[model samples]
Target: MLLTLDLNDQRPLHEQVAGAIRRAIAEGSYAPGDRLPPARDLADALGINANTVLRALRELRDEGVLEFRRGRGVSVASLVEGRLAIVLRLRELLEEAGRYGYSREDLIEMLKELP
Candidate 1:
């Protein structure tokens, strides 16, 4: 429920919302099978339009990070642990790589060479 958005972020509002939700899930704040706040509530909390939040939620669903249920609303995907772990680690890796002068493009190139 504690989603933060940077006023200076250049990403679309929906992407920023999705990123905040992803971080929340990665940090164990919202566990697998947990229901997220409704889009209107999230919109109010994040000061974004409800449609934007809904769009983000839909994207998360498509990414397998979240599940949409007719009566249950939106919940974290039951099998998201493995995926979330990778996502969280990837973020950390990218941040550390930044400090070491490795651009994301550089990391992508390295990964492309993996066996």
Candidate 2:
């Protein structure tokens, strides 16, 4: 999977990494049971510290979005219930956008324009 990170963002590095992975999963770029790149490799690719990637992966694991194995690394968790986790995550995103001054109408307009 192609992962990108913005180091200059106000959000923590680990959060950025985790968010990218989550988006990939939500958009079906990475399906359930797909193994993510090793922490060291991803860190190198994103120009961030390996520990940051590890922490992000751990957060995903805690959220049940990923499963960590002893030697196999992290794999995407199967979808819970019948829908993609994006349903709940989109709510959180909308709430956060509202906090950042995006009106509901503005969000709706953006969504309407999405392919």
Candidate 3:
């Protein structure tokens, strides 16, 4: 999968990385149990610090979308069996937006309203 990060954007680099990976997972680009690139390799490819990639992976892991192994590195979590994972992801995103002052109504109107 190809990932791109915009350094000029206001969002943190790690967030951009996490979001890209999340979107990829949600869209079935990265299947369950697929191993991700090493943090150092991904960092080099993205022209960012290795810690940034690590942070993104850690966040994904915390959100149950990825898992970290001692020797196997990070792999996508098994989420194909249920809708709970998707619901949890949406809750997390909305809660995160709330932290930045976005209300549910605002998000619904902006994101849910059809064009």
Instruction: Judging by TM-score against the true structure, name the best candidate.
Output: 1
lDDT per residue (tens digit) for residues 1-115 in model 1: 8998998987799988988999999888999999998999999988879999999999889989999999889999999999878976887899799889999999999999999
Model 2, C-alpha of 14: deviation from truth (Å): 0.6
- Runs in model 3 with CA error above 4 Å? 80-101, 104-115
lDDT of 2 by residue, 1-115 (tens): 7898765778798988888888888888888888888989999998888999999989888878888888988898876323447644675878799889998789889999999
lDDT, candidates in the order shown: 0.91, 0.82, 0.83
Question: What 10-residue stretch in candidate 3 is worst by lDDT?
Answer: 79-88
Better of 1 and 3 by TM-score: 1
Q: After superposition, how far is residue 69 of candidate 2 from its true place, in Å?
A: 1.1
Give the poorly placed runs of model 2, Cα more than 4 Å off.
80-91, 94-115
If ranked by TM-score, best first, what sequence of candidates would result? 1, 2, 3
Per-residue lDDT of model 3, residues 3-35, tens digit only: 898778787999999888887777777889999
TM-score of each: 0.83, 0.73, 0.72
* Clashes per candidate (backbone, < 3 Å): 0, 0, 0
Clashing pairs in 1: none
Q: Which scores higher on TM-score, 1 or 2?
A: 1
lDDT of 2: 0.82
